[model samples]
Target: MPDTAGLAVRTLTPDAPAEAPPVLLVHGFGSDGAGDWIDTGVAAALTAAGRTVIIPDLRGHGASPAPESAAEATAPALAADLLAAADAAGAATFDIAGYSLGARVAWAVAAAAPDRVERSVLGGLSPVEPFTAVDIEALHRAVREGAQCPDPFTAAIAGMVSAHGDRAPGLALCVEGLRDTPFAGGAWDAKVLPVFVVGENDELTRGIDGLAGSLGARLVTVPGAHHEVLGGPHFRDTVLDVLAR
Candidate 1:
């Protein structure tokens, strides 16, 4: 079923035991749940653990509609979309986890419906909002005008958008929509079952301990960089152990 925002979603279940607290997995910017979770073996691991996983391709990515308007990509809007996915899956309560942009959005979800989210794992994210300093214009220039942009990071982001095929323009719009919105520590409710996970070498690691202190969550650091952390055993084990406990 399509969400209120008409985003595409999928629910994968293990064959042996179909009844388990559902786990909703959200992907990072310019990436879908399948690519970020399924292909990475995270989803498979969850399913093997008898978890029913609901994966939504956030708006402007994967099978979801790429809205031309940037406003459709706001964190609150994406958060609601995840809730809608839960509703569609008939999940009154579920565990949620996300990485990068997805982690930011998951924080929004926990804030929006503290009662619904049983536990959450925020991975590859930091206390400080990652995209606050990003230059959307420079990203657009690199992809649209083929201009020589100074920031390699921004340029690489633009390249990722372009590699996403037809969603390029929409992804760019989403990036612009997310520009003014940074992850606010206040959005993390202390009552929520939240865990903060990040790569040991990730630049985002700064101030994470402070944020975790505020959220009353344990901060777990694994060995790897921001992107590589997701594919490693430590990160995956940390999440699974949290959920298992």
Candidate 2:
């Protein structure tokens, strides 16, 4: 484990000659690197295939320290942290694989360091910002007071945050930070076209087709819901195949 600034990163070295550029695996909201990538064997599989794998526990998630304010936890700030992690790994350029909120962060990373990102696989990403629709005040109230969130969407998000136990407050702050810097897919300017992967049953990414087309990116529909997609062999194989190309 190497600490880059405040981020705790887990690096996996390949057993043989490196077949591809270093890959950064960004995890989703309410979940850390281990829970999303490591536990599902994606990290090990990538390593076995001769790729150096870099996994960062994003700020306020896993071993990384929580941000004191929403400003500090913004997507751009997280993107900067990831670039620093790549720098620490000595990777001048790399590939990226991110899921859900991680996908949004990956978009930020690609935009910030367009020249450094060789390719990207964005999973479960929505055409519009998901958090912009969330009721932030209600979310905070739920986290702080154990009150029920009024909106069904906010309630669902609240449930996910609650699953993390004591980290609910920090996660709530992260959501606020993300909501502050919402995703606008059409505004993306990165030259490197990404491969967008979504589950057929994932309502979150329902309108991603339009965005993907505008970006001239490829879209691959996999076989599960948003949460189940990452852990499935379809996702792993799709990512592996894409990166190998």
Candidate 1 local lDDT, 155-207, one digit each (tens): 77788888876778889878877776677777555255588898888986678
What tens-digit string does per-residue lDDT give for candidate 2 at 10-69?
Answer: 999988846579999999987899999999989888888999999999989999888888
Candidate 2 accuracy as TM-score: 0.94
Predicted structure 1: clash tally? 0
lDDT of 1 at 65: 88
State the C-alpha lDDT per candidate.
0.82, 0.89
Q: Which candidate is the best by lDDT?
A: 2
lDDT score for residue 47 of model 1: 88
Per-candidate total of colliding backbone pairs: 0, 0
lDDT of 1 at 187: 50
